[model samples]
Target: MSTMSAKIVHISIDRDWREVYGYASRPQNMPFWASGLAFGLMQDGDDWIAEGTLGAARVRFTPHNDFGVIDHRVTLGSGLQVHNSLRIVPNGDGCEVMFTLLRLPGMTEEQFAADAAHVLRDLKTLKELMER
Candidate 1:
């Protein structure tokens, strides 16, 4: 197994956990903000697929629950599985949304940084959309 590293990015939202999770947990709502998945998701059995900027990817998101977890697994067309660990937690006066970018094997530092930036922008978009 290849070792992996993570870069954690987050934003504090001016909303309750339930509200935040309700908006973010829907896979169909992804393309509206997540640039990496600009094409959104298409349901295919128990999994969802996206013909996204990164290419065709099949995704499996964590089951719905009241805890505000939004984790997901993505299998790229190249067959590499990327795990995205995301969460929304109650904070004073609001909630905080966190996204963990896992650095996969063979990814260069520059690529990793770019990917992190992409995720940050996506999170910001999510925040703006939800807070609006």
Candidate 2:
């Protein structure tokens, strides 16, 4: 269990959940919208290994499906396992993407804030890419 609380950040997109899930669920597409993972990744079967803002990480994402669950686990270079729970749900005429930022032990308040901001930006990027 984490020592700190988790933060929920969300953004509404003008698209369907299927469309959002189709694009965001793929780890290969991460570099395009996720700034923290913009360095790209190497896929080895079900695992995606990449070096990014948080250092080298091995990521395992949820499989493709109609449900907009884009949850994934990231093992950092420091041996920290972070579980990111992301979801896309229908909202009126569009959809809303929600990202849960889990605060691990030893993480500063500022760092958590920065991570939340980064996720918000990434969601915005996804929206832009999908709406185009």
Candidate 3:
């Protein structure tokens, strides 16, 4: 399995990072900023399942944030697996949010890089929205 990770720094903690994580982690919020082609959210028992189209591939979000991990599975098309994690640490005047995404076998490095960039952008957007 191929693995890739990226980090974003120097963000003010004016809003709860956890909440930001929750929002970004939601499926319905994808169309707001995610570069995905399509997105949807559905209830599966108690947990919400987030599904979206990233290009021609279908991706699913199975949140495990309670354990500081989020699992993403690409079922249709290019089958892939992603384990996501967000780490928040206080910096000088704000907090640093670090995102780690591990790509499982069948995923390309380019795809991971693109996803990481999109996620970082989404986090920045989330931070801005919460600070407002």
- My TM-score estimates for the predictions, one after another, are 0.95, 0.92, 0.53
Tens-place lDDT per residue, model 2, 1-132, is: 526699999998998778788888888898999988889999978899988987889999888767788888999987888888999898877899999888778879998998789888888999999999
lDDT of 1 by residue, 26-69 (tens): 99898988887887789999899999888899999999988889
Off by over 4 Å in 3: 1-13, 16-38, 55-79, 90-94, 103-110
Error of 1 at 14 (Å): 0.9
**Ranking under TM-score, best-scoring first?**
1, 2, 3
- Worst ten-residue run, lDDT, model 2? 1-10
Tell me how many clashing residue pairs each candidate has: 0, 0, 0
Tens digits of per-residue lDDT for model 3, 34-122: 44523555556544445555434445556445542334554444455344555554455445556665554555888777766777676
C-alpha RMSD of candidate 1: 1.0
Candidate 2 or 1, higher lDDT: 1
Clashing pairs in 2: none
C-alpha displacement of 43 in model 2, angstroms? 0.8
- Model 1 worst lDDT window (10 residues): 1-10
Candidate 2 wrong stretches, greater than 4 Å:
none
Pairs of residues at least 3 apart in sequence or in different chains that clash in candidate 3: none
